[model samples]
Target chain A: MRASIVQTSVAVVATLLLFYPVLQIVLLSLNKLPYFRLGGEFIPTLESFQWVLQQPEFWRGLLNSLVVSLTTVGILLALSLPGAYAFSRYKFKGKDALLSFYVVFTQVSGGLGIAGLIALFAIVSALGLRNNLFALALIYAAGAIPYHTWLLKTYIDTIPKSAEEAALIDGAGVNTLMLRVVLPLMAPALAVSSILSFIGAWGELILANLFLSGENRTLILWIYSLMSNVYSVQWNRFAAAALLYSIPPVVLYVVLQRFLKRGLAFVY
Target chain B: MRPQWLILPGLLLFLFFNIWPIIYSIYISFTNANIKNFPPPPPWAPEELKQARPPPDFVGFANYASILTGPASSGFLGAVFWTLIFVALSVPAKVALGTFVGLLMSSDRVVGKPIMRALLIVPWALPLIISVVAWRYVFDPTYGVVNQLLYAVGISKPPDWFVNKDYAYAAMVVIEAWLAYPFIMTVVMGALANVPRAAYEAAYIDGAGRWAVFTRITLPLIKRPLIYASVMTAAASLQFFLVAFLWNFIQLYDRFMLAYGYYWAFGSPFREYGLAAAVLTMSALLISVFMILAIRLAGLMRGMYES
Candidate 1:
């Protein structure tokens, strides 16, 4: 009984630790006292929230986030769907090597390529494309290719090829068969990839910070820039903005938790 | 059956954007590329930064030589050391904690397990940018929750969390683990649900204790998923920046990891394109060498994951 109590206490503590940061942010958003005033009395108000709503940056960031994320997902799916389909069904030379390339390439961690790309984008920005969300989306799509391709290819492999071959023998063209028959069967995989890709693009900051400027900032950049000058940061307003900024990603993850589990299982 | 030529567009983009950058990084290592005297004239202005910034003068191996004998060499070494330590510490901690939480949630013994599990994934579900930023604030010196709670107790002077190098580094590790362990936990819980109940019943019948049953029966069954989680987490921790950099700016130079080094090398106002490319080229070379060795050692090339 004592051991069980100890275990329960430990579990409860761990769970509380997970929720603490979120709680603080929520409280900070609604509180009258600035900086959350840890021991101060709670006086809930919507003033901070109103302040966030009044700022054009919040709406701009929202619009930019949606555009960037959607364009990224669109471009990613366009590339990954076909690339994965071929890798799955085709008997090409160096197919295994190619698959290995994607797998290994994905493991190369942060910003090695981004370093080079920054210089490229600097020049591109000089050519009057600074703060362009499409250009940002294009960079995001290119970066997402290696892993998304691998994921989609693995997913495509699970699907039996008999249906595809049957469709082929019925004199259906390749594109038609892909679009009509195999596509519907691969809905779960497509859904999983799209959600994950959207989440990635939505939260991306490093590139957006460097590539974008002025009013073209994403939600993350806004939060970061607010925090950049730490001394003058209006804590209540920042917290309100932070909480509002987190809505889409939180919603996406919650609504599609099932797909994420299914999708991530294959990633391992 | 003929899904051919469909890969062309992706391949081209990958080549143009991704592969080209990597190759360009290597090529620029041999040239003079810095933004000190940039956009020289009409030909240079509005031209590709690579051609205009870099003098188009081939300075063979000079960039590499400078780094080897540079003031930043020690900083480079320190970054490498800390990167290894960060990876070494965080990966195992994430795996172990994730497994423990997974076991707790999966077991029928724990009450209110549903709420516990939901709360556990809150960090993972939220935007990482916000979560990381929140963690940074929580570790703040005076007005932060952590210090406030510390003062509310007995200790009046709670050491500034992000000031000391050791404290800041430890906080970064903890925050990152908090952010990431959910991935492993969720996966393990799912994997655990698939574990055959019959195996446990048989183990219990054989007079195996709880520990024996877990270590012997449960562990081996879930080993593959655990290994995958470990490798993924390990790779992530190696390049961890968002948490480590956000926690404190002052101590960053003392422990600048490879990712930050790369960021500073080229991303700064007066970009050192040639030297930055050299850094990236060397970093890539080292990584590929390590990866090839890891693959060969594990025999991962020939369908180790096929089953």
Candidate 2:
């Protein structure tokens, strides 16, 4: 089929519109000034990057973000993997009911709103878990359970049960079966799930801002604080930090792109 | 060895982290819990620190009453009104634009389909905070690309987005659509691929026009996925917070349901925890009601489990 001029033009324009904000950020990160102006002078330099790199908070925030995200992924997989395996293999009473519950729970999980936050704050404070990065990661992982379990359950359903049966017949223990047999085969799904959870924990702001403080702030939180500063914001440094912060998630999403369709299938 | 035992650990974690807060929130909403009264030091702390604060008093639905019919009602109602409007407008915009782009790019006729798709995916791929901040920049009154483009096109004095309520809301809807459309597009692209080419061929061979083919064949085929996407996006829009919160946190804090609760709980000087809990509980109830209904309407759980 011949490409229509109208369709091509519309698509091109839409692409440009979508890409402009990111392009603007890229430009702002490179621009010499701390702020942007329309038709601004275009002297580009690495000063903003240098400034961001020089800040001790930058390294701390990045490390905190990494710790939180990786721990979240670890906890998420440990919980969701076994849960998904059971859901896929077992026929328990209330199975459908529980699955339906998960469907609803995952859908409105974010709707917990301030009520969840306030109650969580109270709990975290009471337990003295405030500013604790691992506890924060646990919270992140817990929030992800229903959806990731369902997601991995769906993926597991596709894998033949014959292998597990064969392993059982060979006197393989359940632990060995899971650790050696299931885990390796489920790598792709595990990768998708972990990467998703990692990105989620990495980019999360509200909970991180509420639960963490001072030196414990995540990279996204640090960048947000810079922007939220009322009196003056160094926009160039903010843009540079934001772009740097965005790299991991963007790269992960692109990697996950191949599996996105299948993932959405499980989600809906 | 019961397979069910495997689910226990995750279930306990979910109960602790997800379910417990909600239950606690409901319990707290009925009490006059504020920053001072609640959040007493851990029981493990010394007796003096534990004795430093008294327990919260039970208010017995007073918070709900105040939010329902008292002075705080206006903010709550206004948030409800605008949240509904935002969801109503933005969900369709996102879905439609996504469908349009998905259809255009999925077609064999589109040039550089790979590049176009990659460019489109940027918004969805980038961290959401970054995207929102970049969009906040793009809508900046003085130096924003939106205004710059408006000026270049001979429309001077484009309304300052963050300064005006309507413009800010409009910018939010635009940003929401931009952030979300890629997912819808991906879903549509996936659904479209499932559509049998023979069906389209059969329609064309019968002399059906493009519009007829689309409305009759294409739409019906992708209807379920589209409905699913709409329901999910609508839920997301209903819970909309961060973009608006980031755009102009203080001014717009009371304009969305979650943000309103946020204002009461944290942003406001009073820090009315009970009242904020009441507001958020109502919001959560509304969202669950909408989601359950939509899910039921779409029969989304029909094949979710086998046994």
Candidate 3:
């Protein structure tokens, strides 16, 4: 009984510590005080949200984030579906090697290696593609491909080949079989990949910073700029922006929580 | 075989965007390429221009030599040393805390497991940059929550977290640990669920205490996931850009001409691409070595794959 009480207390404390910062941010966003104090006594107000909404950059950044995220998910699906199918079905020479390579490469750091990426971008730009949203999307998609492919490949392998063999016997072409037969069965995996890709593109800062400069900053960059605009930290505005920034991901988690958990169980 | 062709576009894209750039950057590191030498000097330039130029010359080992012996050499070594310090301090704390919390949550006796798990995921699920920014605010010296709390508790003088080099790295480590533990916790909770209950029961029957059962059964069983988590954490730490960048912005404010330039000069900025590459390559090499060692040590990789 004593041990149980201690365990319960520890769990409660851990939970409180975990939620404290988030609660602080929410409170700070609502507080009307110019400065945020640890235990500030102030009536809540909507001014922070008002200020965040009034910013033209906020709306534009949000729009850009949505576009980039959607594009990235689309490209990821397009590339990974076929690629994953090939890996799952085919027994080509060097198949295991290729799969292992992607698995290892998936562990590479994303944004920390920006210098190399920038050098590559410089080369790509010289080839006539200027730095823009599309280029950024392509880079994001490429970054996600190896991981998504590995993920989808594992999920797709769980799907039996008998289904595809049956579809082929019905005079279905390979593409049609993939589209009509395999895709529907892989819906849960697809949903998981889509959400993962969206969240990745949504919150990605480093690549967005390096690649999307000058009139193409993503939403996170815009929020970062807002935070560091001047000497005085705009606590209210930053909180409002954070709350708004968190909405899409929060909604994503809530809506797909079940499927996402199931998919993660498969991967991890 | 035709289906294999589907991988062509992805393979080519990976080669171009991922593999090719990595190789090219490795090559560029050996040369004296900087921002100015980017376009490469005009085909024909004056002798003085040539003399004054810090061209992309094949001065083999010069850049590495400069990093080792330059005036900024200490800072470079310090950054690497600090990175290791941060990783050493943060990773184990994260793993231990995560494992403990995960075990608590995974246990059937724990109350509010769902809520605890959700709360744990919050830190990890938040956009890392946003969370770092939030943490920066929390650690703000004046009027910030952390300092305010500390001052209230009678510790009147709170250290300047971001400015004081002595504490800055420590602060960074704490925040990094905070951001990272949830991830480790979630993965660990999953791994712990797979821990065979029978083994623990057998340990108990053999008069093993909780510690012995954990050490003999749980720890050994979860070793592979633990190794994977540690390697991933180490790799992620090697790319510690955002904390340094954001800390510079928040702490330094408008004092510096270039927030990024300072990072390049001292932190892992683009100008020192070679050094950064070397650092990253070394990190990757170390991670690979650890991974192989982990496989050998655990003796489970073959079993896991073969099964």
As for candidate 2, its clashing pairs are none
Please tell me which predicted candidate would have the highest DockQ against the true structure.
Answer: 2
| Candidate structures ordered by DockQ, highest first | 2, 1, 3
- Model 1 ranges off by over 4 Å: A1-6, A37-39, A109-111, A122-128, A260-264, B1-4, B37-56, B266-270, B299-307
Highest-scoring model, TM-score: 2
Q: Rank the candidates by lDDT, best first.
A: 2, 1, 3
Query: What ranges in model 3 sit over 4 Å off?
Result: A1-3, A230-233, B39-55, B69-72, B194-217, B249-262, B265-307
For candidate 1, write residues A1-268 as lDDT tens digits: 1136666777888778767887888888898877775676778999999999999998999999899999999999999899999998888877788778877777763645544553455445545566899988988898788788888888888899899889889988878888998889889888878888898899887778767887788888888888776677688788899889988888887767777566446643
Docking quality tier of model 1: medium
Give the TM-score of candidate 1 (chain A).
0.91
lDDT of 2 by residue, A1-268 (tens): 5678878888899888778888888989999987676578867999989888998988999999999999999999999899999999999987777877876788788877355888988888888888999999999999999989988998899899999899999999989999888988888899889889998999998889888998899998888888788247678888998888888998898778776555434543
Model 1 earns a TM-score of 0.90
lDDT of residue A65 for candidate 3: 92
Worst window of 10 by summed lDDT in candidate 1 chain A: A114-123
> Which wins on DockQ, candidate 1 or candidate 2?
2
